[model samples]
Target: MAWNEPGNNDKDPWKKKDDKNQGPPDLDDLLKDIGNKFGGIFGGKSSKGGSKKGASNVGIAIALIVGILVYAFSGFYTIKEAEKGIVLRFGQYDGTVEPGLRWKWTFAERIIPVDMQTTRDLPASGFMLTKDENVVRVEMQIQYRVVDARDYIFSVTNADDSLSQSLDSALRFVIGDSRMDDILTSGREKVRQDVWKELDDIIAPYNLGLIVVDVNFKDARPPEEVKDAFDDAISAQEDEVRFLREAEAYARGIEPRARGRVKRMEQEAIAYKQQTVLDAEGEVAKFNKLLPEYLAAPEVTRQRMYLSTMESVYANTSKVMVDVEGGNNMMYLPLDKMMQNQSSGQRTLPESQSRANQSINTQSTAPDLSGRADRFNEGRN
Candidate 1:
């Protein structure tokens, strides 16, 4: 039977010895009972002295367990995508942790999150002296990112500040070495490139754990006192550059045409030379054929040559005026004009007009050369 079942008054476990008082259990006795139950785990005997000591030790152990659980849970951390975790073990450099939920020894290790993928911008601007001893205000910006998290944390006291200082130093150095005109005008790009290169060279030995993505020359200008003058100078330089570019473009466009024309002229000259050579050779061959005739009859050959020359000359001339030495009459003809008129307007002419035109053409063509024929005949005789 159970101790508290039915009506078994003496066997009831809940029945207190002091039931007449009907009060809460004694605090000391309740603690002793709980202690005795836990005491069994540490092999403590169920006695007054052992129970009290066991209770104290059990309470301390519970507290320690709770503290350990809290510490373990606290060590867990999340690294972001852009960040890298640098793990230091017992205040000494250890290894790195990737992006995820990670745990470390609570009081012994440390994690410093350095954002490696995020590009950070640093700007440097101030009045700087140029190589020409002119003071100018220059502004420059640099984009950088942490490449080595461990180096970033340990190599310098503050990586970002150190990088900033390096950039400023590099900018000033380059500016001091450059001319004011260069910084303010056409050489701005060169200044930017020089600063970038100098910054790289400066930081190369420091191991700043930074990589410069790019350097930008934001602005550069002369002092306010000389602002207008410098603006005018810069404008002039820009106009000069524009003119130079236009000239180059024009040259590029014109060069091909000029070359084409030169080639065409060369080809024409070659064709002309070939034609002249061929014509000269044909004339030489004709003269060779005439050599035999000239030797056979000198006077007849001379007369024929003169007539041939006259015919060739007359063929090119559009107008002719002939004056006979013995006669007082002069003959004039405008054959080219008449032929042009006939071709331009092809009007039907009367029969008599057409016949006159035919007769005139015949007379002009044959030229009534009886006098020349007689002269040639006499020479032949």
Candidate 2:
């Protein structure tokens, strides 16, 4: 039967044989027995007085060892190459740490790592009034990096946020001082430069510990309400610039050719003038050389000059006239006309025989030809 069952008469299975009516041992006695067994295993005296004290000392030592391990492990940390750690002791600034493995008191110090080498971007965009009282939407991008870890962490409440506000303020200030046409077109670079300068000035006194690497004027445009009109205006402006450049190129190309033509004409005129002057000088020199000869023999020179002049005149003439000394008739020979007639299918005598025949006819017609020839010679002398 089961122990403590009605039929078993509440018999205790673990009781001694001499015990009677000692139903179930007392709770305090059982606890004491368990404690004595544990104390004996751990080298503690099983006597009631010394066992409690020995157990308490063992527990205190274990607690102390655990606390030491937790504190040691919690202090170790690592910093990245691009980061700088800001240490604070008892909520007050301590010092900074470089990148590497480092340790600090677990609950006494705190480290805040700031990324010093990372380039952060702050964008500012809004519709702003131009100097000409026009609204323009301008978008700008500011690239920056943290220069001082301590200043970045403590000098400002929020460095990035403060920088963003400064950027907006600077952009607006620059845009407000600029004309709309410049902002939308050729003045973008100037606007970008102005914004960068103004932003730096605004943050200089605040010591935000940020270095602005570059400022990009991302986009600038008129509002959507007049987008098409503005686009047309911009296109027209572009066309004007293109036309001006093309015209300048054309002028540059044509100027050289024009100058060359002018130079060539000037050279040609110089050559013509020199030739004329040289010819006149040669004529004067020849006349001077002939003056003495003419003075030495005036009549002979006069006759010779007259004959020479007549020879030169007749050499270029196609008609010839001969005056007989004592006859009233003059003979004419149209050689050029005769030659044209002959080529047009008319028969003509040989040139030499024709001249001979003309001479014979003239001699036969003239009377006293020798006396007339003597008279012409006497008249010339």
The C-alpha lDDT values of all candidates are 0.79, 0.80
**Model 2 clash tally, residue pairs:** 0
Consecutive 10-residue window with the lowest summed lDDT within model 2 = 362-371
Please give each candidate's TM-score: 0.65, 0.68
Q: How do the residues 1-381 of candidate 2 rate in per-residue lDDT, one tens digit apiece?
A: 767665545467656576665477755555555556655666656655554555565565567779999999999999999999999999999989999999999889999999999999989999999999999999899999999998888888999999999999999999999999999889999999999999999999989888999999999999999999999999999999999999999999999999999999999999989976886687557555655555566556556666665565454334544667969766667777876865653235466555545434433422343334446567978
* Angstrom error at residue 219, model 2: 1.1
What is the C-alpha lDDT profile of model 1 across 276-338, one tens digit per residue?
A: 688668756755676566656767766776676566545533454566785876566677787
What value of lDDT does candidate 1 attain over all alpha carbons?
A: 0.79
Candidate 1 TM-score over all chains jointly: 0.65
Identify the runs in model 2 with alpha carbons over 4 angstroms from their true place: 1-57, 296-381
In terms of lDDT, model 2 sits at 0.80
What are the clashing pairs of model 1? none
